[model samples]
Target: MNNLIIETLSWGKLEVTEEQIYYFSKGIPGFDEETELALIEMAESPFWYLQSIKNEGLSFLLGDPFIFYPSYEFELPDNEAEELQIGSNVVVRCIITLKEQVEQSTINLLAPIVLNPDGNVGKQIVLHRSPYHTKHCLLQEQPAIDGKDGG
Candidate 1:
């Protein structure tokens, strides 16, 4: 492709290459038009953001759950495994919902976005039966926005 464009909910414009684009078999329900996406840097810190190159301005902040919360773990459904061609034990990330309090920031653990890098398939798989909530406090309580570890 000559021109691959991506739009973000925040960041406006960004150019993407064929290799950078990812395909999600069951495309994001709300955003069906956005079939291609690329993960990129947000600022100059320990945070990364995923931007939709197909849309005008749509992006979400993402991070490794294990990095912040070590006990994070999820089970992939059988059908999802077959769809994504999941190889070995892999993981999908969730778009964190940050609060002004910083420490109050929470992540959607129940429905983490799962993807298979090898298959280029991604999807937000919802956990129908689980104790996990939609908003799991990242730090359990108020931490700090020092742009460092939540300590």
Candidate 2:
């Protein structure tokens, strides 16, 4: 119980110190009770998945929405910003949609779970925008791979 152990692809039993774990207040939708989460690299994938040790079976795929959608941007309502203490030190991230094919994947840019990595505080704020969807398809075009072909 000394360190937060998260299973990862590259680093086995990804040990995250208590100081490194972030607390998601209000948790993800339909999972409000799951407060604590540890972010670890998705084994052999470009995404980072949040693991809820308390729930065991609960976990979500997360990533920098901007990584895929460089133009991706959103505003957290005043209430959410105040609740999360999203000061200048916080970082914003979104959950990516899981697809059978990697190219068909999409990130939830409309609702991002902003986190204050330094303070271990977080909240998922929804963006009431029509241009973006909760399930936007990723990679509209086939991205060129320099070395390995698969994503």
Candidate 3:
């Protein structure tokens, strides 16, 4: 329950507190055997690394999808909500896939990793009824202040 030293493949040795650990009872999709995860905040950025304690090499780049898609929304199925025992305070994060160009990165909008900050429980739930796709372009042309794209 105290600060534990975690050996990660990418970040090397890190001293993380109990509050940074997330427990996934059913584990994550594709990596069902991994139940213990830790959130490693990126340096001076909105992105984070979701690392699997079971496998030091297993890690993911995550970000708050809302930062890009303000209107993005989804409903957690009743069963999943009950599984995490989470209410309105749950934190939702999406995975990012970097392309050859950083501007061409994509985000997985179909499945989101939900974390119950209060209980330290989390789950990666696939949204079958979502209107979004798994690979949404992470970077798009920004609309100009004058109402026209500054292309």
Candidate 4:
């Protein structure tokens, strides 16, 4: 049980285990320099913090896409799956952009962060010719069950 102390802008110094760290060989888009990151699960929440190990200020809030978009689905390319050495266990998360108004928050569905827990490797994949986009409302209103406008 190896423990590592990392500094974060939001939570300050955090003690994380080696298993919590993920290596992105190609690095995340717009943050190519950051190859190593710590995935910290938020307690009692469907969100996680992807904190950079080298840069304390660099971090991203990630969310379970399915929690926000139940019907969200995508086909992972075989090459990508092989590149990450993915077997059966694969974790998917989307980067979330939180706004002052909670309702205005958006999640990036176009580029999803996929991880292979066993290998401790991850990659942000960009889906092509897909219906999803970069910014999808995080808190979308569910359709009325009665098919009424709720007038």
Candidate 5:
């Protein structure tokens, strides 16, 4: 198995397998210069870190959007599916912006990181004409029941 050593701001040097490295042909939205990234899974957690192999400081904290928004759903365009050469297996993750108050944290649902694990390729897909936005609260607010006194 081929392994690679990558530098990260948070985790320092990490030894990752070749399979962990994902190639982004068009690069991510803001950081278009970075084409290669490593998807590092956080142990015992639903979150994952998308670390740029070339730039140690460039990384994103990603989370499973469905886990936070149980009702979240979206249709992948045929052209996008074809662009990634996606098969039956595909992984989706959203960038998370953590705040001092955890409840205030937000996730970017407008643009999601879609990966083709089999092909080791990924793309940040921006949803068009969608209800989702860039800053959706990571934690869902609890609904209050009608103010009714139980006799």
Candidate 6:
């Protein structure tokens, strides 16, 4: 059932689908009131735009943290997992905050958005005592090359 919804975003107007809509029962930390969000794919990129259907101005740039941080792992508490009806095949994504320089972009590892692909239910869960931080730089500074080593 692909129900088209016309929305005006920062980039311009877009037509989203029903399957693309995600419902967050408890809502995200900052945007608690805005529960309905549309997961729009970014053209030619792995990133996705989680736009709020309730508010045109609210949207977030999301990314699959596992793509960049292969070793990244977080345990979902039973309570949260049960609430979202998520099983082992859940999709986990983190919010990406871009800086002036693209290389300086950071992902919010402390909190991750977990979704049940089958049910289309999603929730942003904040880890209670995780080692991850909100600003883990995506790009590492390049090492200086020696001018004498011409070989």
TM-score for all predictions? 0.77, 0.78, 0.88, 0.92, 0.92, 0.88
Give a tens-digit lDDT track for model 6, residues 1-151. 6676656468677888787888998778877897888888898887998998877788999998988788899889999989998766798889999989788799998889998877889999989889998888765453555776656
Task: Count clashing residue pairs per candidate.
Answer: 10, 0, 0, 0, 0, 0
List where candidate 4 sits over 4 angstroms from the true fold: 142-151
Pick by lDDT: which candidate is best?
Answer: 4
Using lDDT as the yardstick, the better of models 2 and 5 is 5
Location of the lowest summed lDDT over 10 successive residues in candidate 6: 139-148
| Range of the 10 consecutive residues with the lowest summed lDDT in candidate 2 | 4-13
Which ten-residue region of model 4 has the weakest summed lDDT? 142-151
lDDT (tens digit, per residue) of candidate 4 on 76-110? 99999999999999999999999998878999999
The digit string of per-residue lDDT tens for model 1 on 73-133 reads: 7678899888878897465677789889777788887887786766666787888887787
**Models, CA RMSD each:** 5.5, 5.5, 4.3, 4.0, 4.8, 4.2
- Off-target runs (Cα >4 Å) in candidate 5 are 142-151
**Of the pair 4 and 5, which is ahead by lDDT?**
4
Taken over the whole model, the C-alpha lDDT of each candidate is 0.72, 0.75, 0.88, 0.96, 0.94, 0.85
Which stretches of candidate 2 lie above 4 Å from their native place? Answer: 6-13, 42-46, 142-151
lDDT of 2 by residue, 59-82 (tens): 788887777788876667788778
Encode model 3's per-residue lDDT on 1-151: one tens digit a residue: 6898888998798888888899988888888898999988888887999988768799999988999788889989999999899977899999999878777799898999999999999998899967998899887664345666777
- lDDT at position 79, candidate 3: 94
